[model samples]
Target: MKEYIDLFNRLPNLIILEDEPLARYTGFRTGGPSTVLIPTEESSFVEAYRTIINNHIPFFVLGNGSNVLALDEGFDGVVLVTKRALNHISVDETTITSGSGISLSELCRVALNHDLTGLEFAYGIPGTIGGAVYMNAGAYGSEICNVLNKVVYLDENGNYREKNLSELDLSYRHSIFQAQKNWIILSASFSLEKGDHDTILGKMNELLNRRIEKQPLDYPSCGSTFKRPVGSYASKLIDECGLKGFSIGGAAVSEKHAGFVINKNKATTSDILELCHYVQHIVKDATGFDLELEIEFLK
Candidate 1:
């Protein structure tokens, strides 16, 4: 660990912090600390990432930290925060190119400003563009693959490469990035259409309102605890199994949305994990359908 820290410290213009708390960065708001690296420039980020990988040091690339639950014991390696160095947006007519670190909401705002449609479905998604593309994030019958044209990423050999939409192999909450662990998303190009500004804004607001009405927006939670099972909805199954409002330690199945397990009273990562497992077990036993988690767990 000392050697790893020393190697990271040698990278110029990179900000290294010891025992940095991760709760403040994640939506769950409950996690322990880890060694965090924040690069001030793209060159520094490339150097830091290469150095870590070449030295076989354990590391994870992080975006907005939305759809992940870091364990109580914390990550024992480096946390590379992409937002610190890779946030940039550019518009070329109806095409928009964005860095992976930029937030989905901010991207939507950019589209709205340029009268670009096709990104309205992402208006309220609380995640970075990288995570969105990696997960093929979607809402209201639309997904990121709808507008994505190409992606620039770091290959396994620390070489930068680009892939077009067809090669991405995108599907419901799955992408080629999930299968290739060493592929690090850097930026993406999206093809949109020109539309009326007022109409686009109205659609975005309508979707935001619907999300607020159906989701537990006020609570600290990874949105939608389980994936929508084929021919069934995970939330409906949990609700039917009488798991809504169920409590385990400081965690509870949200009364407003059975899909969410929220930190109602400073819940620990263990509490959330236990509660999610219990919900999955009960829902499966009752409905004969296995509930797959939508959020990733980091340990």
Candidate 2:
């Protein structure tokens, strides 16, 4: 680890932070510390990722950190932070290309500024374009799969290549990327339609307001705790089971929106996991719904 650490510090466009708190990066603000690597350019990012893979160094790629629950013990290896490293964007006519590090909100804003119509559904999603595309994230009947044209990613062999929408195998909170965690998303290109700038802005604002009104935006949460169960909504089931506002330590089911498991006060990672399992147990026992978490629990 020390040799690799030294090697990373000398790499171009790479910044290294030793013993950095994961809490500072995650939305939940709970995990412990680890060495973090931030790559400011695509080549440096690819090189760092390749070196870690070849050297068998454990690492996790992080984007906006909104859809993850990292353990309190934190990772022992490099935690690659892409929030700044991969935040690049460009537009050509009605097509847009963006680094996986750019936040969904930022991507949406870019689209709106260019009068693009198709990305409004993702305007307020908390994660980055990579995470959103990896999970096939959707809202208000629209999904990333709808507008995504192709993606550039580092394959298992550390070779970068382009993949089109159909080749990615996207479907409802799942993608080939989920199965192949080593497949690093570099950037994504989208095909969008031209629309009135005012109309796009209005739609983005409307969705953001809906999130504010219905979600516990004031609290720290991993967005929706559970995926929408077949033939039913997670929030409806949670509310029905009398679990709204149910607290376990500092973590609780959000009263504002039952779909969310929020850090109400100062919750630990353990507290959040416990509350999530409890909700699963109650929801399954009461309705046979077998609720599944939408967010990942990273340990």
Candidate 3:
């Protein structure tokens, strides 16, 4: 690992940092310092992985950092940040191609600019392309699966390849990535439909406006805390159990939306986890429904 650090110091395309705060990098703004941080450029990403493999060092890929809850102890292993560095977007008529690190909101805007209509439903979602594809993220009855044609990824063996949408097994906030280990999404192709620019912009505005009006956007959160159960909404279940506005330390279920657990003020990762567990337990006890977490816990 020391030799790998030395090698990284010599590599121009990679920037390495030690004892860096994971909080500053994540959307939640709530973790301690990480042992090592590496931001690699497109030309250096594969090489960076090779170096980690050769050195037998544990490493994890991170994008936008929106859907994660990093512990206060932080990550002890190597943290690979792919945001900004891998952000690339290209659009051609009804197709949009984006790098894994590209933000979903940015991709939606790109589609809007190109007069593409299918992505308007995702206009206000925060997170990167790879994160969206991995979770098969959805909103307003539209999902990544609806527009995804195929995805290009680095397989478990670190070989580059592509797969069709049908092969991904995308379903209700889950994808093949959930079961498959060691694979990293590199990019994806999305198929959209052509529409009038004004109409596309109108739809985008409507979705964004709805999100702002209904969600607690003023506070920090990992968005929705739980996935919707079959034929039921998690928020409705929690609300029926009177979990809304419930607090655990600094974390609280949003007064505005029962689905979200927000950092009301200086909330710790522990607080969020506690609130999530409480909600799950209460909802299960009251309604016999097991609420599955949508947020990814990172430690």
Candidate 4:
């Protein structure tokens, strides 16, 4: 513990907190405290990451905390927040380069302002650019891989590097980043085409409205709980099994959207995990389709 604190203190101009409550950082709003480090500058981020790697300490690179569920016991390592430090966005003609911490919604607004049309599908997706690229986030028949040109990342040895879109192996909510656990996403570049600003904004607004109407946005959730299975929707299967509005503790299957598991009250991590496993078992037993979770469970 002394070694960890000493290393953390070496990086100046960084927000270091001990046993910081994690629920405030995540979308589900239910988790315990963790040792968190928030770097406000790019140089500090690099220094902090390098120091953590050198010390052989366990750590998690967190973005907007949109698609993760931290356990009730909480993480026992460094939780590095990249959102505040790496949030810059620059436009070069029709191409957009953004820091990994920028939110999808914010990126969409930037694209619309620049008269770019390809990112309308991601307007309402609640995740950072880094997490979206890592998961190949998609909606409305389009994915981030379609527009990604290249990405900057930190290798296992704490060396900075870049990879083209073709090297990312992006497909169906999977990316090379999953396999390369040590590689940390830093920034990404997207190639888009110019379009009428009003047209782009109109499409973005339509998608946002669709999400607001169809999804249970009023409640706290990690977006869609389960991924869409091959040739069928996960929501339809759960709805068919009559699991909608099923409550286990404070966690409940959303009444509005069967695909979501929401924190309807003061839910615990155990409650959510139990509810997920229950849904998976019931769905598999009834339909013979094994439901896979989309949210990453952080223990």
lDDT for each residue of candidate 2 in 1-299, tens digit (9 for 90 to 100) = 55679768768999899888899888788899889899988889999998889888888988888888888998888888777778889999999999999988898988988888999999889899888988899998899999999999998779988999999999989998999988999999999999999989998899889998999999999889899988999999999999999999999999999999999999999999999999999989999998988887555
TM-score (C-alpha, index-matched) for candidate 4: 0.98
Q: Is candidate 2 or candidate 4 better by lDDT?
A: 4
lDDT measured at residue 69 in model 3 versus the true structure, 0 to 100: 83
What shift in Å separates residue 230 of candidate 1 from its native position after superposition?
0.3
Q: Which stretches of candidate 2 lie over 4 Å from their true place?
A: 1-3
User: lDDT per residue, candidate 1, 61-156, as tens digits?
Assistant: 888888989988888988888896788899999999999999999999999999999999998999999999999999999999999999999987
Q: Can you list the residue pairs that collide in candidate 3?
A: none
How far out, in Å, is residue 236 in model 3? Answer: 1.0
* Candidate number with the higher lDDT (2 or 3): 2
| TM per prediction | 0.98, 0.97, 0.95, 0.98
Candidate-wise lDDT, in order: 0.91, 0.90, 0.84, 0.92
Model 2 C-alpha lDDT versus the unseen true structure: 0.90
Query: How do the candidates rank by lDDT, highest first?
Result: 4, 1, 2, 3
Winner on TM-score (2 vs 3): 2
- Top-TM-score structure, candidate number: 4
Model 3, residue 261: C-alpha shift (Å): 0.5
Candidate 4, residues 137-209, lDDT tens digits: the string is 9999999999999999999889999999999999999999989978999999999999999999999999999
Sorted on TM-score, best first, the list reads 4, 1, 2, 3
| Candidate 2 weakest ten by summed lDDT | 1-10
Error of 3 at 286 (Å): 0.6
The numbered model that scores best in lDDT is 4
